[model samples]
Target: MGYNGPLNNAKYLKACFTKPYKFFIHSVVHTVSHRKGGCDVMKDYQICMVTALVLNKKYNFSIIVFHYMKENITSKSRILVYLRFV
Candidate 1:
């Protein structure tokens, strides 16, 4: 038999990876919701936004580089907004 990798739960692994993306989306929604109060919450909100971008750049190897142009694989975080509507 050919070398097959360890037998593991694929669904669970997918859930683990997608969780961060979902959380990122959720935080943005919460920020918009709370933005209407006209309070100083946006400063802290901006910090959270920066932190998410840093995490995506730091941890996601998939988005590190493009296949042909050699440009960084920019994350489509805005796609999360579409997801929220769906």
Candidate 2:
């Protein structure tokens, strides 16, 4: 987890973990929504896993490392953090 702040209503669950010297990370993203229908205030959760050259390197580059889908492992988080994966 890098940052945490939400003194009142909801303190989101943000986390980040990595293996030393590894060029990858695992994180969970949560979306908070408020709607006319209270029941529709539910959220959508997604998992994000990425690998890239973000360290001390000559050049910087990032590419889709993996995608996780409930039905197919061939897919990963897209709707929320699609830009990061690209």
Q: How far is candidate 1 from the true structure (C-alpha RMSD, Å)?
A: 15.3
Query: Model 1: residues >4 Å from true position, as ranges?
Result: 1-17, 34-86
Q: Tell me the TM-score of each prediction against the true structure.
A: 0.20, 0.16
Clashing pairs in 2: 1-16, 67-75, 67-76, 68-75, 68-76
Clashes of 2: 5
| Top-lDDT structure, candidate number | 1
- lDDT (Cα atoms) of all candidates against the true structure: 0.33, 0.26
Off by over 4 Å in 2: 1-18, 21-24, 27-55, 62-81
Alpha-carbon lDDT of model 2: 0.26
* Clashes (N, CA, C under 3 Å) per candidate: 0, 5
lDDT string, candidate 2, 30-77, tens digits: 121211223211122221222123333342222222222222333363
Cα error of candidate 2 at position 14, Å: 19
